[model samples]
Target chain A: MINATLRELSVALAAKRISAVELATLFLDRIQRLNPALNAFITVDRDKTLEMARAADVRLAAGDAGPLTGIPLAYKDIFCTEGWLTTCGSKMLSNFVSPYDAHVVERFKSAGMVTLGKCNMDEFAMGSSNETSFYGPVKNPWNTDRVPGGSSGGSAAAIAARLAPAATGTDTGGSIRQPAALSGLTGLKPTYGVVSRYGMIAFASSLDQAGPMAKSVEDCALLLNAMAGFDSRDSTSLERPAQDYAHDLEQPLRGLRIGLPKEFFGDGMEPGVRAAVEAALAEYRKLGASTVEISLPSSGLSVPAYYVIAPAEASSNLSRFDGVRYGYRAPEYVDLADMYRKSRAQGFGEEVKRRILIGTYVLSHGYYDAYYLQAQKIRRLIANDFVEAFKHCDIIAGPTAPGTAFEFGAKSNDPVQMYLSDIYTIPANLAGLPGMSLPCGFDAGKLPIGLQLIGNYFDEARMLNVAHRYQQVTDWHAQMPKGSA
Target chain B: MSLNLDQVERIARLAHIEISPAEAAQTRDRLNAIFDLIEQLQAVNTAGIAPMAHAVDVSQRLRADVVTETIDRREVFQAIAPEAEAGLYLVPRVIE
Candidate 1:
């Protein structure tokens, strides 16, 4: 039962072979056994789990179940849950319980899904390795000493450990894909505004997108079908009609034109990751896909640009937490302003404070045009480069990260080294292009290497089709780290 | 592009985040390194290029000014408040 894909789990539920309560209990037991080491979950309430599962079972009994109904999934802590703590991995929000469901949570509830608990993330979604999370870093299931990539590291690690069959993640500059790559799960980040951002905690408004993370492309597609749609609450939400993101999962890949970015394949890549990505491309060739070399000249500038833009937005968004209305407050203060300063200074972790300072410096009177505005122009060039390349290729392919997961404190001391880990995955977010990552092959040390597929704007269905075809030909996505399951 | 201690202090004040002298010194070093990374953007020839706010070219959607949400959860909202008084939030005196 634990080994089944999301589709098989749903099938078993429909056949009455397993009840939702039983499934939730099974996972809850596994989490109890494994969670101490991984630190993937921040909140796990068995009472709440059984309550939701009981309702899901009632819906299943009435024959009113959707494919995901009664399916237990992990919600990234970034999303607001009505009563659950949505900390966004910061002490600032540690005690803040949501008053309403985020748009994504509402949709999942409507589908009659069971929420297992809130998964951990980086503090305000600011770091690459999950170490900045107020809770603790999530360990890679493959190796206890190494990190699971972040800020969606908990979601990725949960799925990798089979704690949750499927989960949700938010990507602002590769939070979803990079973590999924390290933890060996299938993760997708839809085109911007494709998924509503109403309840998800704001990171970089323009770059943050909520999507699915699961064990298989088919599972991710099914979750995306529920997640992606128009929402009036989010001003930027696209007004496009609902899409069945899984509609083309079985499509053939004959004549698929794959563009390999020259910058991504060159110097920065680790040899093991390069070899794994090459092997996956070879598999695609056998499936009748042709590869072409392409250039995204300005993509190398993505890290700098993203740092400026995301933090500028985050500084503004996070200002709402000024120790007054909600969240942490200084126990003692000389005045209201002193309260705000002390609370925020103490509430936010080191990386969050660093980014806020940088944001304030850039958006300040003198530096706005030089740093913020200049980076936006670089952002335009990066997006334009992708637009030009897409004219010749159906999809772009690359290694999701330069290397496999690293030990804690490896790059945490140097933020630039940490930022470069996301160099390959950031371009897609900058372009608002749909991107997904799945296990291509494992490194020599057995860590997973993710094969990234970047599609044109709103081309998620085709990209999933591309991924599903490759998944069908390879067993990498099906492999698991050594565990009792 | 580097940020010195005084600039870091002023920026922290501007952002409303308090920092000790020790933290400010460490922050200056880290912020300087980040800015050095960002300095590479200046190397690009971006004259007359429009700054991109969003990747997609969609404008903000307009909605009617009429009230759409009536949840009226001020009670729920204030329930999480660190301090509240008379159905309003309690805070330190802003004016003398």
Candidate 2:
């Protein structure tokens, strides 16, 4: 039951082999027992979960249930789930009970899916390591000593630990892919605007995109079909025709061109990770796909540009928490100005404050042109690099992160080192391209390593097709952490 | 490009975030380190390149001005506020 894919779970659910209440209870019980060691879930309401499960059971009995109906999944704390505490892993929103649901949450609810709980994340989705979360770092399920990647670390850990069959995650500068990579799961970040951002806590408006994290690429595709849609609420939501992301999952990869960006394979990658990524590519060759040596010359600039652009946008978006309305407010302050200062300082975590400060500095009067604008221009070059590379290849492939999960304090103190961890994954976010990470292999230490796939705009089906084909022959994604059951 | 302690305090003030003298000192060092990382962009020439503010080039979709959300749950909205009175969100006094 713990290792079942979404499709298998759906089939079992439709066949009435397991009642939705029983299915939900299975995962809810797992979460109760395992979450203490992992800290993957911030909130789990069993009564509420069972209530939803009972409702799903009703739908299943009615014989009008959808593929996702009665299936339980977790949501990252970033999404505004009404009646649930949407913390975004920060003390500022620690007390925030969302009045309404995020668009993604509404979609899942409409699908009749049961919400298992809310997963933890980095504060305001700012950090590369989950250590910055107000809730303590989510320990990697593979080896509890190492850290789960962030800010979607909690979501990845929950799925990998079998606390939930699947979960939703948002990627702003590799939040979804990097954590999915580190935790040995399959997670996808769709093309920008594919999923509406309304009511999802804004981190970096342009870069922040919500996607799915699960045990398989097919599960990710099914989740994406429910997640992607046009919403009048979010002005940036794309109005493109709906796509069946799983429609091409069975497509042949015989004539596919996989782009291997030299910049991604160059330096900073651990030899173990390199070996695993290369072995994955060799498997692709056996499946009849060819690799093309491609160059994304401006990708090296992605990290610096991302640091500037993401923070600059985050500063403007986070300015809403000024002790006026919802969220945390300081108990004592001399006046309005002091209230704003004290509330924000007392509310936000260190990394959130640091990013806000960096954002304010870059967008400040004197530094605007030299920092923010330059970063934006460089962002264009990075995006243009993808446009050029995609001309020669159908999809770009590489190592998700430089290495496997690291120890808790490995790169937390050094922000630059932490920022560099997302070097390969950041380019996708910058370009608004769809990218996914699937389990490739394990390191010598038995830690999981991920292979990243970046598809051109709205080409998610092809990417899933490629990943689904690879998953057909490899058991990497099926390998769970020891003692996960 | 490194930020001094005073400059860090000034930035904090502009950002409306409180920083103690001790926190400011530490923040200055970290911010300087981050600035050192960001300084790499300064060496790149972006001549004749337009700033990419968003990944997509679509213009913001205009909507009808008519009210769409009819739910006037002022009670629900203000329920989470730190302070509220007579359907108004109350904050610290702005007037002297």
Candidate 3:
């Protein structure tokens, strides 16, 4: 039951082999047992979750249920679920219960999926490791001492630990892919405008995209079917026709052309990780998929440019929390100005405040032309590099991170080193492309290695197809950490 | 490329936050390390390149000039800090 995929779980629900309430209770019991050691969840309400499961059962009996009906999934704390604590993993929202549901939450509810609970994350999605979470850091289930790659660490950990069958995650500069890589799960970040960001607490508006973390590519496809859609509330939401992401999952990749970016294989990658990724590429070659070396010269500049662009947008988006209408406010202040100052100072975590300051600095007068404008031009070059490279191949393959999850606090004090962790994954986000990380191999310590596959804009189905084909010939995705069950 | 304490203070003020002296010094060192990494972009010859802001080249979509009903200001201000007995967010009296 713990290792059951979403498809198997759906079949079980339809056959009355197990009810949604029973499934939710199994997960709730597991979470109650393991969550203390993992710190993967921020909020879990047994009563509320069972209530939703009962509703899902009713929908199933009514014969109006969808594919994901009665399946349990966790939500990243960033998405505001009405009446649930949507803290965004920060003190500012620690006490805040959202008055309305985010667009993604509404879609999931409409599909009749039961909520497992809200998962932990880095505060306001700022840091690469989950250590920056105001609540606490999430431990990698594979090795409790090792860190889980984050800002989506909790979602990845929850799925990895089998506390939930699947969970939602938002990627801005590799948050989704990195954690998924470290935790040995499949995570997908769809095209930027594919998922609506109506009430998902803003991090970097242009780059932030919510995607799914699950056990397999097929499960991710099913979750994406419900998660991706057009919403009029979000200005950037794409008005594309609804797609069945699972349509091409079983397609053969006999002649697929995979482009391995030469720049991604350059120095700065751990030798063990490079070996694992190369072995994965060899498997692809054996599967009748040919590989070619392509150049994305501007890929080296993605880290620098992303830091500036993401923070600039983040600073502007976070300015809305001024102790005015919602979220956290200081208990006492001398005046309105004092109130804003005290609230922000006390509410935001250190990393969040640092990003806000950097963002405001780059976009401020006199610096905007020099810093913000220059970063914008470089962002275009990075996007164009992908455009040029995609012309040569159908998909791009690379390592998700430079190395496996490092020991916690190894680079905590070194911000530059931490920022470089997302070097390979950021360009896909910058280009508004779809990317997925699938478990390929493990390092010497049995830490997981992820092979990243990036596709052209709105080509998520193709990416999932390639990943699913690869999974058919390998058992890496099915490998679970010792003692998880 | 290292930022001085004064510049950090000024940036903090412009960002509408207050920082302590020791905090500014620490932030200066951290920002210096990050700025050093960002300096890599300076190596690219981006002269005469048009700055791209949004992903797609599109103009802002404008909505029709219709009167959208406004929410009750009094109700909204009810949650506002420093609110007085009336519908306003009260601050200390500015004028003597």
Candidate 4:
């Protein structure tokens, strides 16, 4: 039952096979069992979870429930959940209770979904590895010594361990897909602005996007249907009509053109990961999709360019968390300036402070044109590369990361090494294109290697279609860690 | 392109993040490493490229100036402030 996908859970829910409260309790119990070892969830309030479940139960009983009604899903702590501790895995807001709900949180609430709990994340969605999380790094369920990828590490680890059926994650430079890749779950980052970011803790606003992470592409599609829509409140949100992301799940891949970027398959990739991604591509070929070698010339610049832009945006966006109005305040300070400095320094983790400093430096008067403006120009070049690549193929394929999950401290010491893990996934976020990752195969050590599929802007349905077809003939998504069961 | 301790200290102040002297040395090394890594981008010819501010070409969206959200819950919002007096967040004195 814990291994069931969202579709199976939805069917069971709709048919009254299980009560909403019962389902929430089942997962809650499993979470209580496994979360200690995994650290997937930061906060699991039984009272709040059960209370939400009871409300969902009422909706189910009244026959006013939607497809997601009674479904229990966890949210990454970045989203502000009214009355719940909405820490973005940072001590700055660790003790802060939100007064409002994030747009994603409100969508789940309206769908009658029960909040399982808040999942852990990198502090303010900063790092590629979950090690940056102040709550403690989430362990890869496959190997206890390895990390689950970050920003959405908790959500990914939760799904991988079967602690939760599905969850929401935010991606700013591969937060969703990279963690999804490392944890061997189906992670999607829809085209920018598909989901509103109104109440999500801001992190590089331009690149930040919320998407679904689940056990299967079909499950992700179902969740995306509920999570996406136009919101007038968020200026960046596209005013597109709502469409079922699951509509094309059964579409044949006969004429699909899959682009294999020559850059992603280069020397950067581990042999095992390259082998797994190549195997997935051959499977697609058998499914009648044709593969083409495409060039994304500017992809090489993605990591450096992202470091400049994302942090610049983060530096500006996070300025809201000063010591006065909300969030952490220094316990001892002689003056206003002293209070602000001590509060931020003490509240934020290492990576967060580093990013803020870099952001401040780049956007500073003498450096704006040299660093910030130049990164934006590189952003344009990278976007142009995707535009050129997409013209030749329907979707781009690659290894989600250069290698499989590594031990917690392996790349944490060097920020550059950590940033490189996101190389393949970052381009999509840069271009605001939809991207998804799913388990293709396991490496020598048995850690999962993900095959990433990136689509043109607003191409989620077609991408889901392609992923669904691959999942149909393969069982990679079905495999779980030996002890997880 | 590497930042020295003084620049790191200045950047920290600009960012409103206080870094102690011991931490400053390490922060300088890390930031300098990153800056060195990014220095490669300077070689790309982007003279004619228009800077992309977002993934999609979208202009700043505008709405009618009518109040969309009311500050009616101002107190509720400030309830979490570390110190508040009469619904005002109390910070260290700005005036001498």
Candidate 5:
């Protein structure tokens, strides 16, 4: 059961081989035993989990089960689950138990999927490492000393540790893909509007996207089917006809054209990661797909542009966290202004504060044109680069990150060094393209490396097809972390 | 383009977040370093290029102005709030 895929679990439940309560208990027990060392989950309620599982069993008995029904999945704490503490990994929300459910959470509940618990993450999804979380940094299950990539670090770690078969993640700047890469899991960040972000704590509304993190591409594909849909609540949610995202998984990869961006393979990538990616590319060549050298000339500016635009939107979105509303409030203050200042100062982490300050300064007087506007224009250039490159290939392939997971505090002090972690993955978010990371191989340090694939707008099925084919021929995605095993 | 301690404090004040003098000094250095990285945007000639505010070009979808949330869950929502009084959020005294 621990090694079973979501499909296998569904079949087991359908065949009356396992009750939802039993399945939930197995994972809950595993989490209780394993979570202390990994620090993956922020909150776990066996009673709540079993209660949901009992409902799933009722649905299964009534023959009203969906493919994902009765399956257990963890949620990144950013998504507000009703009655669950939805701390976006910040002290500002450390005491905030959500009164309502995020649209993503609502969909999963309606689909009958059991909620395992909420996973930890970087505070407000601000940092590349999970160290910024108020709940403390989530350790990589592979090697506890090394960092798990973030801001979806806890979700990545939970799945990597086999504590949860699947987890949800949000990506604004490689938060999903980078961590998935580091932890040897498959995670996809769908097209910007593909999944509704209603009720998910807003970081950068334009860039934040919620998607699935799991063991295989097929699992991610199935999870996306339930997660993607239009919602009246989120103005940005795309109003498109719903279709099966996994329908093309069995499609042949013959004549597939994968774009290899020159900027991705150039300097900045470690030798181990590059070699692993090259090997994955060679394997794709053996699968009847060809590779083309493409250029995204403005790709180098993605990190800088992202740092500007994401934080700008974040600054605007996070302004609602004043002492008045739902979050934390100062215990003592001279006036309303002082209350806001003290509450925020004591609530937010250093990285979050840094970004908030950067956003404010850039949007402030005498600097908006030079900083924010210029970044926006460069964002156009970055997106245009993708448009031009996609004309030559069906999907883009590259290393998810520059290297494997590093030890804690290795790059934390140097903010620029930390920002560069998403160099390859940021361009996709900037372009609003669908991007995913799957385990290709491991680095010299035995940490996982992710091969990233970026699909054109709304072309998720093809990307999943390509990844599913690759995963079928490789065992990298199936390999388990030693500690978790 | 680098900010001094004074400017750092100014930005902090504008953001409505307090920063100690020592924190401001360190923040100024970090912010300047980040600006140095972001300075690359100035070199790229974005002349005549339209700034892309969103990935998709969809217009804002307008919903009916009529109220949709009929449920009165004021107590439920305010249950987790720091302070509340009879369906109203409480804040520090603003009136003299």
Candidate 6:
């Protein structure tokens, strides 16, 4: 039951084989037993979750159930759930409980999905690994000593460990896809503005997007169908018509063009990861999909460009969390200025402080032209590279990360090495194109290797279709860690 | 493109955060390394290419200027600070 996919769980519920309350209890129990080892969740309210489950069961009884009507899902701590602790994995928001639901949360509730709990994440969704989370890092379920990838590490870890059937994650510069890659889960980051961001606490406003992480691409598709839509509240939300992301899941891959970017397959890619991605491409070819070697030359510069642009935007968005607001504040201060200084100093983690400083420095008057402005220009070029590549293929394929999940603290001392992990994933964010990472094969140490599928702007349905077909032919995503729940 | 310790301190101050001397030194080294990598972008000629800010070329949507609703300031400020005796965020006096 714990390892069942979202679609399976929904079918079981509809058939009266299991009640939503029973399923919720099973996940809550799994979370209670396993979260201590994984630290994947920051908060799990049994009362609220059971209440939601009860409501879902009632809806199911009335035959008002949808595909996700009774499935349990975890929310990354960043998305605001009214009366729930939406900490955003920062001490600054430690005591903050949102008064209203984020658009995503409201949509999920309307679908009658059970909220298992809130997963942990990096503070302000700023870090590559989950290490920067104030709550502590999430352990990869595959190997406890390794990281689960991050700012959506908790979400990935939870789904990987079967703590939740599915979970929601937000990506800003590779948070969702990278972590999903490391943890061997199917995670999707839809095109920017496809999912409303009204109450998902802003990190890098332009780059931030919320999506689903689950056991299969089909599950991710169902979650995406519920999560993606137009919302007037979020100024950036696309006012496009509703989409059935799962509509083309079983579409035959005949005549599909998959672009393999030369830069992605070149240096910096681990031998094992390259082998796994190549093998996945071979399988796609068997399914009648053709591959073309293309070049995203500007993709090599994505990491540097993203670090500057994301942080520059982060510095501006995070300004709202001053001492005067409804978050952590210094207990004692000599004056207002002292209050601001002490509050921020005590509130933010080391990585958060480092980014704030870097963001401010780059956006500062003297350095803006040299750093921020140049990064913005490079961002355009990176996006253009995708535009050019897409003209030749329906989707681009690559390794989500350069390598599999590294041991904890392996690259913690070196920020640049850690930043480079997002090299393949960052370009998608820069282009505001939808991207996904699905388990393709295992590495030498048995860590999961992810094959990334990137779609053109608003091409989520096509991307999911490609991923679904791949999952249909391979069992890599079905392989779970050897453990007793 | 390299940032010295002094420059790091100045940047931190400009950003309105306080950093210790040790952290400033560390940040300087890290930022310099990152800047070195970013320097590669300068090699590309972006002449006449309008910098793209967003993926979609759509213009920003405009909304009517009419007020849809209003919030009570007193209630809004209620959670601004731990102690809000008045309709304001209470803080220690800064000015002399």
TM-score of chain B of each: 0.92, 0.95, 0.79, 0.89, 0.94, 0.81
Candidate 2 stretches with Cα past 4 Å from truth are none
> Would you estimate the TM-scores of all the predictions?
0.99, 0.99, 0.96, 0.99, 0.99, 0.97
| Model 4 docking grade | high
lDDT of 3 at A436: 92
Taking every candidate in turn, the Cα RMSD to the unseen true structure, in Å, is 0.8, 0.7, 1.9, 1.0, 0.8, 1.5
What would the per-residue lDDT of candidate 6 be over residues B14-93, giving only the tens digit for each residue? Answer: 66676788777877888787777767876777776667676567777898998765764557447635667656666776
Model 6 Cα shift for residue A172 (angstroms): 1.2
Clash count, one per candidate: 0, 0, 0, 0, 0, 0
Per-candidate interface DockQ score: 0.89, 0.91, 0.50, 0.86, 0.85, 0.58
Give the alpha carbon lDDT tens digit for every residue of A188-298 in model 6.
Answer: 999999999989999888889999999999898889999989898988888898988888888899999999999988888999999999999999999999999999988
> How do the residues A1-485 of candidate 1 rate in per-residue lDDT, one tens digit apiece?
87798889999999999999999999999899999889999999899999999999999999999999999999999999999888999999989999999999999999989999999989988888899999999998989899999989999889899998889999999999999999888999999989999999998898999999999999999999999898888888999977888888998899999999999998979999999999999999999999999999999899999989989988888889898888899888899889999999889999998888888888999889998999999999999999899999999999999999999999999999999999999999999999999999988898999999999999999999999998888899999889636
Q: State the lDDT of candidate 3 residue by residue for A346-443, as single tens digits.
A: 89888888899899989988888778889989988999999999999999999999999889999889988999999999999888889999999999
Among all windows of 10 consecutive residues in model 4 chain A, the one with the lowest summed lDDT is A5-14
| Candidate 2 lDDT, B1-96, residue by residue in tens | 878888999999999999999999999999899889899999999999999999899998887789888989899989999899999999877886
Q: Write the per-residue lDDT of candidate 4 for residues A190-236, one digit (tens) a residue.
A: 99999999999999999999999999999999999999999887899
Clashing pairs in 1: none
Model 4 spans with C-alpha error above 4 angstroms: none
Candidate 3, B24-83: lDDT as tens digits: 999999998888888888778888777767655545556788766566455533543334
Looking at model 5 chain A, report the run of 10 residues with the lowest lDDT sum: A323-332
TM-score of chain A of each: 0.99, 0.99, 0.99, 0.99, 0.99, 0.99
